[model samples]
Target: MKKLLSLFLMGLLVFVLAACTANENAGNETEQPDGEDTETAEKVLYLNNGQEPTSFDPPIGFDSVSWQALNNLMEGLTRLGKNHEPEAAIAENWDLSDDGKTYTFHIRENAKWSNGDDVTAGDFVFAWKRLLNPETGSPAAFLGYFIEGGEAFNNGEGSADDVAVKAVDEKTFEVTLISPQEYFLSVISNPAFFPVNEKVAAENPEWFAEAETFVGNGPFNLAEWEHDSHFIMEKNDQYWDAENVKLDKVHWAMVDDTNTEYQMFQAGDLDTSDVPADLSEQLFGEGKVEVVDQAGDYFYRFNVTKEPFQNENIRKAFAMAVDQQQIVDFVTKGQEKPAYGFVSYGFTDPSGNDFRETAGDLVKTDAEEAKKLLAQGMEEEGYDTLPEVTLTYSTSDAHKKIAETLQQMFKDNLGVEVQLANMEWNVFAEEQSALKFQLSRSSFLADYADPINFLENFQTGHSMNRTGWSNAEYDQLIQNAKNEADEAARYDMMYEAEKILMDEMPIIPIHFYNQVFMQNESVSGIVRHPVGYMELKWADKN
Candidate 1:
């Protein structure tokens, strides 16, 4: 299986993590039991989630904010271990057919959900079928398209009965794939593949909405969820491997501001926090910052259906105007690399070359070329003056600063004045998903370790492709890449697809992401997989 090292090795190789989760009235539960030293009775870690998790439902909580916490509270057939490779979790072991398109997983004999029900093979079948059901409306549904009939079912062209997954027996779960997926094991480690308890979910479809009803089968259990304020997780004694679990509890706060979070960290309320951009240099110079590697890019998308951006030349002009290098050096001021292509570094191709290096720079940055393109685009549209442009971003001091910098860059490089707008992450995410914004900042963390994971997002009508851009050829290339059994040929198709995406200019590359944060030295053993999300299972406080 491909390891998370495909995400690039910066410092620690262990998938390190820190505390997080919602707290309802678990306030009393976090208190120490009698006679134990109040300070030493329970090993508790407090951390921030930045904002409320979009949802707790396995398939529904697709974003990092939600998946990071869910990663601990729920167990998938496989889980990314401290080494960042998929290891057996609910499924004790699995076998692959000689064709490499079918997988049979063996469930653990002692595996039990938080509610004490067996983590059965039936649960996996039910959850996976739910994901492919067109009525579920899950954005993460596309991730499962590698499964046979998943695409047809999700696209409403087939029924759930057509999906090639089933419980062979109580302990045996089977899944057949449409093709040979290189990252199948790693991909299934994503929170979206976690099985939902069949009985609990059938009784209460809204079981994931609150702490009282959530029944997870991982290292931790949701003991309290007070919504936007905070949430709490207590260690699950029922976990199959609970004997090895370290942390007793985790408290996750939903504060979105980095500066405020840093202050709370300084005040000792938070065990860890993201380094404020202003303090990044100071912290790094003091040897206090940890540069966590991530396989993803922080970029911007242009809604091609919106005015001005509807012109390809205009979109390219705007994309070429902003210097990604300058933005990384001045605005983000971290250990991030400026992105020249959609895919970030460290994915080793079949021939053993980094995919990003192999693809080279697809995005352009020539100021003169940008100015000419802008003028030509305006002339072609017969506009006496270009339409007013607004750059939208979510609520983050970092996002705001980057937007301001981009606005200024447009003014200086192309002589185009642009307005800036910001909204809370939820509102911004919803608006962007609905194609309500012309130009907006966006980030993508690889759901799995593969170049195709990054390149597949621009396909026509894909949930990730909110830009309203469509190219039949590009879509076909992605489809071909997915089905191609030869790794070399598959990668070549992905390379071509990326080039086509850049040529269309529906998006601008900013910088590749790295999780730059500070963790108190006293905390240890948190596992943060580079594919995406953190695992608090092995975390310990002193």
Candidate 2:
């Protein structure tokens, strides 16, 4: 009996020991790092960018899409905030001269580029000079022309060294302007003023085109780029404020078709996508759409250098024939407001009055009056019948709808046959820049909140003025506005400039844009500036 009791005790001891060991192993497997669960997935944001970026190089990127990506990958001396106010980015603080003609910026010592290079004042000097270099052919070079001697250098009449930008020290950058610009701070927030690493750009001209060579000082860095499909950006560990950057990674998918992007958003593939015009109403009603009042305008420019468009009466007649209200209501589904002037609504003058309201409606649609004007124009041009006009737009379902609507309107109202053409975004942009189309669709988002931002584009020799229209009186008014110190006087001069622009009819205003996009409920903190660009630094994926 003593031997049997001893065997049973030994067996029980072994069984208890095995059970404890199994429990210990299970506990070890369940243990997490830092006392947090290990199963938590990585935070990521998936966005459909709508079109491929033209260039990530700051000086060359002038379009909205390119600016969107560049705004993430690069940091300027200042950044635009929610209300289009200038906020510090690389420059910790700045000083403006009493006359406001000079600005001195103190670079942040903690700022570091993705490649570990210290971002310095010299980078700003080099970037400004490079942009002003005529050989660069930067479309945004005009943005730099506000600086003293900038225009002269870009015109190839002055030496680059004569440009008024200089580095006082490794951390101090100075810029001298031609005159006191009220919106100078806001203007520098544009990507055109972003600094570039001199060493990287000198070594690789195609640095921005590839992931290996691209280095930026923003909150994110390029990780992988699959041409025409997508690109991924990982959080930049070296960013000055990386701790506050909630997203670990961002994936931008290039899906040009709005319907495809919407489908992707529905399928859980895209966290955010551009809302198609047809679906905007439905989405808004469902509380799935974000409507932003953008400081921009959607319009079509007439190539005044081209045959029939060269006639002022022809341009005015066509401009008056189109019913802007109908297009905005039916085509954009009332998402946008009919624009009668070049400057968009929402911008307030110094007197606290809306600029658009001050500048009233410059043009109005009257089908009967339009027919009379067209008859008179045809008589003046000594043509029995108007020539068939071709209108061009970028490839997108919304653009196609707008183009078709306009085509039908011209045919029905004026008895003029119209042809339509469409091309990829990049191709269309290039063709428009080269002035290769008779009539082409275009839009301009304000670089700043000032009326000069819109009025300056139509200046006599401005690169953005693809219509080949020029008037000395209009140019004088813009110059006067720049030099006018009194706020009321400055506004008066700008209003006159806009009047001239409307009378010339180089471009017909369609509607003022309201940013209509959709985002998943879980995605939050994606900052959309009043100027219509997305800031994703504070964005979080829940």
Candidate 3:
């Protein structure tokens, strides 16, 4: 919320050309009939996952680490194409009812999983029901609430049979939505909507737990997994368009530290790595880093049930104490714009205006005002001395640096000495989601290219709302937007909801997420979607 402060620290979609083949068989070994040496080399791409995937089960792996890999290992009815728009994948095409609430998809007859099982429309019905099944407790269930009766089923108010998804035939999948959604096609491209192998799952409930048991219909198949260490994906020759998948293997390492990952890249162990904050200046100066637009936010959440943060005024005070411009300029140094609002800059409204631009700044920087609010909050709590505050973050060199910067900023602006604590990502994520932290780091990558996707996270009981934050008016506004048929009216509802979310101060806006990385010259065709995910169908390495 603080727009400017003393520089204390520190920080696209990038479209690479698609390479059709490898470089002169660099790793080949063979003797031609004429005594010429010749052989083919494996086109392997090495990447760092930054952490272990939350889960391989499509519905359960809702975060970046898992979705990044899942996107390659599975396909939904529709998938994001190289242009960052949804295109037919497993479902060759679909017919939308004139009223627009019902959709009938025609699955490709040749689509097959790695195990050679034909992908059927029933798989979609099974996966969708599993996602909305209250017993499954899928965190991404909210993403499917667009479907008619989806919310009711997930809320335990209705049976799975109540959900409006059905396998009309072996190849026909039909779904009825609560209302017409402009982003439905794009949203389904998310991993939460990926179809599961119902046959494999029925025989082995834990089919997704190990490489041997895993099955995928995407461009790659899980070949090896070592839990927290690394995993490998080999090209799935059974894929519908396997000929287009250029990479032979994808090796993913769970390295949380960017500096270490960068070192690995320099050592040729990885093909690409995040530009470390310390080296951002150098890498950027050398023009090795490419910054691409992404739709999402990087922020911190306040657990409302926790002391100090329990007071709305105190939450606002803490938020106002942050100098986001300082964080991006010196700390992150990734050329990201400081975020003063919840929604990222993208989504064009029916009026043809950027949602973020039209919404304008929701909060401002005022050192005096922040201090006044802190005092008033303390008075409201009748505290002789405010309770201690702890700022928590998951393990990451960059996150730790940002947390430290926040610590100094709070001290400078509000005279609050906030302690710092951290844990590995998996543990930190679980604890935070359970509301075990007073204040912790959080991020939101758009599930679709729409403003509502950014605004829906704070709804009263949404799984993404880990801050113990609940606002009835905000929730109603979101619900109204979801049901509103008028495009102009829907945009208005989202704007109002976002404003209220910022006013309540359950979260502090830091900087919007972006596709900022340094890639190898030898690697190409790895498309980074503006929706903040990678497309490696055509990725290749020499």
Q: When superposed on Cα atoms, how far off is each prediction in RMSD? A: 6.8, 10.4, 8.0
lDDT of 1 by residue, 321-428 (tens): 989999888889998999999989988888999999999999868899999999999999998899999999998888999999999999999999999999988888
Off by over 4 Å in 3: 1-40
> In candidate 3, how many Å is residue 436 off?
0.8
TM per candidate: 0.94, 0.92, 0.93
Better of 2 and 3 by lDDT: 3
Query: Model 2 — which ten-residue stretch has the worst lDDT?
Result: 23-32
Q: Enumerate clash totals for all models, in the order shown.
A: 14, 0, 9
Give per-residue lDDT, candidate 3, residue 445: 90
Residue 453 CA displacement from its true place in model 3, Å: 0.7
lDDT of 3 by residue, 380-456 (tens): 99987989999999888899999999999999999999999999988998999899999999899998899888888
Best by TM-score: 1
User: Relative to the true structure, how large is the alpha-carbon lDDT of every model?
Assistant: 0.88, 0.85, 0.88
Candidate 1 overall Cα lDDT vs. reference?
Answer: 0.88
TM-score of 2: 0.92
